[model samples]
Target: MVGREETTMFHRDLHPDGRPVKPEEREQLLRKVLPPTSYSDETTRSTSPKPVGRKRRILWSRFVTRIHLILFAIIQAVFSIYLRSRYLYHVIIDRIYTIMYYPHRTPEYIRRDVKALSRLPTHISVILDLHSHDRYDADSSLENLVNDVCEICAWTASAGIPVLTIYERTGILKEYLQDTHRAITQTLRSYYGQHPPSISLRAPHLQSISPPRSPNTLPADATPPRLEVTLISKDDGRATLVDLTKTFAEMAQNRKIGPEHVTGELIEQELSDLTMKEPDLLILFGPNVQLQGYPPWQLRLTEIFNVEDHQGVAYHVFLRALHCYGKAQMRFGR
Candidate 1:
């Protein structure tokens, strides 16, 4: 017996009335049967176009970069202008001062004046600021300082300056005395090889004057002069001052002298007796003109000249300092 084939129903074709459905209708029926799912706002937004703030942020970033560049350029321009103006001001001022104060003083005139005055200062002291070591290139700065000292010594010798004292706060010159002496000797030999003046470290005692040669010494000044170089440090000043005070106190106690009797002159004399001679001229090589703890007693009548940045200092600078010293008129409390 022939039987009718049984019909099968797929999930998409299923309906309450048992009728077949199209693809679109089946999709709609499935959607109604399933529960609704919740989606995050961020997920939904990400699927759409970016918001207005994104374009604004991009524009703001570009604006900030341009502003930074503009600010940097402006700062550089201002700094350049300031430096140029400063340089111009210095040039104008220097020219005016030179014209007014040094009208007849040509370079040759200044040099001659310095040479003549160099012979006058029996004891000249150079004070170097050791504190500037950190600010400069160490090796180059030291080399420059050594060369400067050597040149100054040779020049002093040439000009018949009898004694030179080099002072530093750290005793650096004292520590390098041998090297300094050798450098000075070399410099003198290089400059005046034929008849180099006798340069030696000054002894602690007062230098003795040679007795007149057989009473026919050509006015007692014809003999060749000697160049005595002394290396002094802050330690010398401190030690001398301490010793001087102690001695003065002891003498006063023993002699029953009052405080009024121990005058500044007395102290000065005592210090001079201890240290031998006071400096006639004191040249300071530093940033400022003030003496950085130099021996107070020695500077009573000393003419001080300041030259900034002693490293690689030219011979003309030293000559200029000497010229200044020569021109200065000291009243000494007239």
Candidate 2:
């Protein structure tokens, strides 16, 4: 019965004439229909030997990886050392230059340049980085500060700059304005053998209106020209702008005027009445270009110049700053 069933299954592919297929044809058809038998795991294991060079390749890869890591570390170390050497070299060179080739500007040369400027700034402001004060011995730092202030005063006196403002970050100058002013004036008088200028000191809270002067009232060569020296510090802060704006807003509310009526001219006039006039040129003496929380309202149209390492800075450096400012083409919000 089993043989008959198998024959029936095989006969399903027979020709329509009902003739049984030939043995060679039936064998070929069986070969095409059946799946090939797979080898057992044991047979594969016996036939295939383990790859000969796998361990060698792994060891070589590890060795190469270690070599790459070692090279990268060496390169990193070399680059770090190079950067350190470069920085030290630059510092040494800067010190050498300061000791040897730094140019000193004479009072006559400064005066000449001041006159040569197409239009001299009416007011000049200076920012001193007192954070650097700890770099030197306390006494030496104080002496240097005095000398720097005196040098600035001498420059302003020579250039006939009428208004000079000084700012420090921590109120150091503001706290010692009387002592600093006395020292600066004494140094100027001793050095120049004449009164330098009328230096009027004012605090941030103080308000004083300068008397109006008619144009052409003062001669060109006015000796000991009226110099207004204003000293301010962090105590003033940026609240000057905020306070001014608030005052104007309150005023507008009280007067029942529109906020648009509060114009910049009016704000500036009020500020001038409270503080000194806005600075035209701001000379920052430090390693960085940051203002370090300087009054923002005054710097809107100001030209800024930076001097690196201003402690015991050369006079020619100050002159060069002025020269740069003179060459600058100012477009006051054109």
Candidate 3:
């Protein structure tokens, strides 16, 4: 009756192609005809940038973490290599020097080396690390530290370094003073027979040792010592200062001297009398540069020397320190 009602899927009967379209089928058709969501989805774009920024931050953090790990590994590797190489270098050089100077006991040879230096220290300070008798020190005394002290004393005396201050951290050297002096005498006798440098051995706050002459040597004919040896310990470094402070306070209370008179010069003079003078050169026997609680007040203008990776004390190291001192120029805060 209406010119054959137009039969087409668009008819208002609400059936898409003879049946209602399923939700999945409708979504698929829409997606196929629609543009990319990234370009057309304006409502979701603000949250989209948020996710992108978050992702970028996560990537950046990961990158930085990786870089830090890489740098740390490189630095650690370099430091390890440097330590190994440094130790090897010192060992080889020490071996060569030992061979060249096989016998270091010749007095003339030592003197000649000293004479070549531009200057020599009058007072030399030595830091000794404690060592025990073992296969390494079979030729030395069972008391290795004592033996080292005696050897150093002999070397200093031979070098004409009159004032030698020996600092041992544990004060073990103080216990073996007698043995050390005896050994030093023998070593000096080897260097200068019959006229070994006279040594006056004393420790801080203790009386100078005046023992009976050894059975083999002459009794005192009333001659002063050429070498004045002082034994100081960690205690002497700080305790001595505390003692001086108490002494000054006691004196001030007694009206003996005013606080104004307790100046640096006065304190220095008192210290010089109590301990040895501030040394012109300090020789550390160890490889590292550790002061080991040396008297702080005395090291204000001192020159310090050490050999890298050196395990033990040796005469050549001592000699080399002296040579270095000769080549140095002291400003003293000019």
Candidate 4:
């Protein structure tokens, strides 16, 4: 016999031998086959397209972040330059400051603002509306009224402004003679200590509203003017106040005294004289007080704040008034 042929099959060369193989022979043939796989080692270790796409996304995110930072830096540089220049001063100081107060209650914001104003050299004025009986005290005693005045004076002094507390009731002053006189005198002394001649307390000359004689021919009881008033809306009142101011300017220019306009002793003696002689500034607070019996004559040249009594007297209001006064041009109607 010819020597038996020993042939091994590769996995891909499993073609038919033209006869069924025995189980043992099939097993031997399978064992002779090698495992099938791709030929390139580099292709097997290569990164997938999904991972490459993620890397590109991360790089794009970094680029966007850099652009935002660059824009923020540019904006900061522009703001810094603006602040460095004097252009910001007008915005800081250009405003009319004013405040309103209920007769005796002081708000906390007012105190904070007062502390702020004390640091500055600006002069501020406060107008107070003190109710004599029902408002200021539960006991309706003169001592309470006097105490209220003292408190107000102290507040104004703290803020660096002289207090000009006005009351419609001359009776309140007369009633509180013992208490108010001492209180006011003490306030003046205390205020002058801090501000020297910059501070003073003023009470306008009281117009005598005495009862008429003759019971049979007695006049009807005169109703006191309203302590509260709603100043015409700011727009309307501003125009009217401006017009009145213009008229007063004309009068001042003429310099001739008119009989119809009787200057009250309070207006002539206390406020107008002082303001005109000093020619500094008068900031009227609580313009809604009707100014009915106030220093109406002086208000013409004065920078009237005319805030509502409900506006609550506070430090911020005064600051606003001072700011407005500072920015306002004293044309004297040139």
Candidate 5:
């Protein structure tokens, strides 16, 4: 039962073949089987030393990475500059001239750059309502209105653009014209009779009025009275419309009539008139802040501009407006 004991050897023991265990041999085996404790020291002492240029190669790779980052930044900057130059050349300068020379296009001039587009004309017509002075009432200052008109005429004449005035009603036109004539005479007398630009007030051909409605107008069982629109034929449809908004305001203030009643009446009258008149465009001014029941039918077809400040109506603004009209696309809700 007693067997021979198995032999055991220390790490420094000789091999079973009886060769002495060399330190180099042991270290070589350890180097292959285990991670290095300190590569710098161990590698320096090794018999087969690493190539001397290995450190230099690693440094060269880092330098190459840095150079690549710098080149990428420079390329990005050059691309940005090229794109900006292209936009300025193609969209801003080139397109503006092309738009200007296009055929069948009317030129509108603006004194100030109201729109963001880069190109437009230098002269245009402007029809404006005189808000500084009252449009209605027998006692308001017709002289002030005339002065404003004179300024507008001078501006238009200077810009080589034609201008026109529209009357909301015949009665208002007649009154305005009479007062304008008187104002011209007075100004001439004061300034030694100088001839001023000939200004005229235009009126729609037909005036639509709501018929007086009573219980008898519609039977008790019948629906309430409704407006019967009458069509009138006319040629001078593009006259500048003047709304007597101030008059209506005054009337409402005095309780002579409700604002709704006045607005309704005006809307009825103007809608019918405008359908026949067929104005080219609408210029809203004065106290006529919300179109004020004026020419709804014509308005659908007309381009509108609001100029509440009568004194600020410059020739340039008028020119720009005309230019805008020239450039407008009239597709009718297409």
Candidate 6:
């Protein structure tokens, strides 16, 4: 009885008329008794938002959004058309060039085509993307990539570009290094006779693969007549830079190479020794000019070639890339 009285006294509702409150009336009586802010004043405040201004703002925002979408759609359509047209144009031109330029008969034929160029790259790097119409299956894409590498290697060899590096971002080429070497040998044999230019197939960390010298070829020497073919991947890209940095840090700590010894020339020399030297020309087998992570450090003055909407590695595109490289004047940051 005393407890009930105490509770009633604490929660008593005596708003103006001194009314005892029920559960339904408790909130109202308490609010009436308390000093309410202007926003909460039941007599003066509105719970719903104003309709006219809000609706007008919403309508304006929707209208602007619609305009942006339309503009974006139009721009996309135009760009798609441009890419398709450009790809077709290149295909037709390349087809025409093949009849006159592609070395169907012999390696000498391709060499003749190469001879016409004002200059030729000593080292050529081809960026091979592991992408194809074979979307659902990865194995199919890998085969296509291998075939692309084989074809490009043979072409570069025929063009007499002494050094070639195959850049596939995934490094699948390096993973299947032996198979790639065998395939390249077969491809070269198809182009040349049994004894093609010797290909030194090597990846970054693996042992270099070189087949036995055919009796029909040159005598055993310190450096035989061979094509230095390298396989590089994303690991050889920025990852190499990071690794190099770590190595330099360790070396500096050990007092081997000082911090000042880590100049651009020093890094370049180290990288060249570790990997291949900077390529003179970089050929992209894809339709557009996307690096797709070719080593940035190696591409300071490299001549890069791209054909819009063109897909796969074509011999004609390879030839055209060479032509483009020959014509390009490397000012080297002039």
* Whole-model lDDT values for every prediction: 0.65, 0.69, 0.79, 0.43, 0.45, 0.80
Q: List candidate 6 segments past 4 Å from native.
A: 1-84, 214-225
Poorest lDDT segment (10 consecutive residues) of candidate 6: 1-10
Candidate 2 residues 1-334, lDDT tens each? 2355455646785644677667886786576555554545667777885676677888999999999999999999999999788767756756664564333434455576567677777799888765455565766666666677777877786687888888776766665667776776676566455534556666677543233445465456755566677877765656776787787778777986687777888877777766667788888765568888887777878889865544435555566577788889988778
lDDT of 4 by residue, 1-334 (tens): 1112324223323334645456676566555453434534445557435777899999999999999999999999998887566444532432323214321323234445544432432333334444533564645644555555565555544444432434332334544344454565465445434222222323323222222233343235521111111111122223433554566568766975454463555334433323321223333444354543443443555555644332344444555665556567779889
Q: What number of clashing residue pairs does each candidate have, in the order they appear?
A: 0, 0, 0, 14, 11, 0
Q: Which pairs clash (backbone N, Cα, C closer than 3 Å) in model 6?
A: none
Candidate 5 ranges beyond 4 A from true positions:
1-141, 154-163, 167-173, 181-276, 285-289, 307-312
**Candidate closest to the true structure, highest lDDT:** 6
User: What TM-score does each of the candidates earn?
Assistant: 0.56, 0.64, 0.73, 0.34, 0.32, 0.73
Better lDDT candidate (1, 2) = 2
lDDT of 2: 0.69
Better of 2 and 4 by lDDT: 2
Clashes of 5: 11
Per-residue lDDT of candidate 6, residues 105-203 (tens digit)? 377788888888898899999888786548678998988888888888788888878899888877878878899999999988898775577888998
Task: Please provide, for model 3 over 222-308, each residue's C-alpha lDDT reduced to its tens digit, 9 standing for 90 to 100.
Answer: 232478889998998888889999999999999999978999999999988887689999999778899888999899889999999
lDDT of 5 by residue, 72-130 (tens): 99999999888777656644543463355322111123222334544432322233334
Q: Model 5: which ten-residue window has the lowest total lDDT?
A: 224-233
Alpha carbon deviation, residue 84, candidate 4 (Å): 40
State each model's C-alpha RMSD to the native: 13.1, 11.3, 10.1, 19.7, 20.0, 7.6
